[model samples]
Target: MGLDDDIAILATAPVFELFERDALRLLSFAGERRHLDEGELLFSRGEPSDGGYVVMAGTLALIPRRPGEEPVKVSRSGLIGRNALFRQVERPADARATEPSEVMRVTPSVMSRVLREFPDVAAAIHGGMAEELLDLVRGLSGVQERLTRLSPRKR
Candidate 1:
């Protein structure tokens, strides 16, 4: 795909929705494009993560560590390894290509450079993370409320 196509894909992705077109263009230019054959392993569990992958085509299977577990199939235009963008974490599951696939690899180093260069992008990312945290807290509060309701009343 061309630069415009890449930008379009990035713009539509939920993770990049807060980013401007210019930021998306910068990401497209800096990111590496990788192609995998069917049944190829994209990444394995416990591996140190450098970045995330934006699927451009085909499907990837996220396989759990436990044997006999059903793998989660992710299709086109999905983002994987999102935490890698902000932290140095290990892969939680094995990712394999279920079919011939194309992905754009976005490294944390590259993102760090971009964030340094564009303070606005960094601010936006921070805001997004804050919102996510707030949502998680709200969800937990609801769960706590449900647990309280389910518990027996004290004398």
Candidate 2:
């Protein structure tokens, strides 16, 4: 997509809507846009995550696996990983493309500046993050329930 499309998507994005134009401007100072094909790995579990992604199009899947267990598909989204823009840590799960995808990989510097310069943007990001976290908790709860149901009981 073109810059106009990017901006439009950004403008409508929950995380971007939280910020001011100047905070968005900070993104101009960092990172690059990247396109990925279906089945491509955005990142593997435990990988050192340097940035976060904003989905421009297509879908991404979060797959979770435990030791000696099969990988379980957890959640999918067209717009995700926005928190990676601000987080400084490794990803716990793997992100893979379900279709040809376009995403904005925003670096920490640009993200930090946006948070510092635009309170509204920060609020939006926090809200988006809260929702994401809740989604994750819900996902995990389902997984745990399924696992409990499937596991053999000790009697």
Candidate 3:
């Protein structure tokens, strides 16, 4: 694909939407592309994550660690390892290419360069992440409340 095509796909990713054209250009120039054949193992559960992957084409299946859980499908325009884009974290599930696929890998080093150069985008992304964390906390609190009510009453 051309540079414009890469940038276009990058722009479509939720987090990348915060980046400017210049930032997108830098990402397209610096990011590495990896192609996977159908049934390829992209990453395994418990593996150390190095970066994030933006699915450029085809599909992937994020298989849960628990046997009964359904695998989540990720197709074109999907972003995997979103947290790994900023920090190193162990993979929680296995990621495999369910079909021939192409993905762009953006390392934390590249992300740091982009954020350092574009403070505004960095702030925007940070704020967005903070909100997501807060929302998670709120949801957990609600769950706790429901669990408390479900507990048997003592004398």
TM-score of each model, in listed order: 0.90, 0.63, 0.93
Q: What stretches of model 1 exceed 4 Å from their correct place? A: 66-69, 153-155
* Deviating ranges (above 4 Å) for candidate 2: 25-29, 66-79, 123-155
The C-alpha lDDT values of all candidates are: 0.88, 0.70, 0.94
Query: Could you tally the backbone clashes for each prediction?
Result: 0, 4, 0
Q: What is the per-residue lDDT of model 1 for residues 1-155, given as tens digits with 9 covering 90 to 100?
A: 88988888787765776788788888999999999999999999999997998888889999998999999887776888888876779999999999999988889898887788778878998999899999999999999999999999999
The TM-score, computed over Cα atoms with residue i paired to residue i, of candidate 2 is: 0.63
RMSD in Å for all candidates: 1.7, 6.2, 1.3
Highest TM-score: which candidate? 3
Pick the lDDT winner.
3
Q: Which stretches of candidate 3 lie over 4 Å from their true place?
A: none
- Candidate 1: worst-modelled 10 consecutive residues by lDDT: 9-18
In model 3, what lDDT does residue 154 have? Answer: 94
Per-residue CA lDDT of candidate 3, range 5-114, in tens?
A: 88898999979988999999999989999999999999999999989999999999999988999999998889999999999999999999999999989999999999
Worst 10 residues of 2 by lDDT: 70-79
TM-score of 3: 0.93
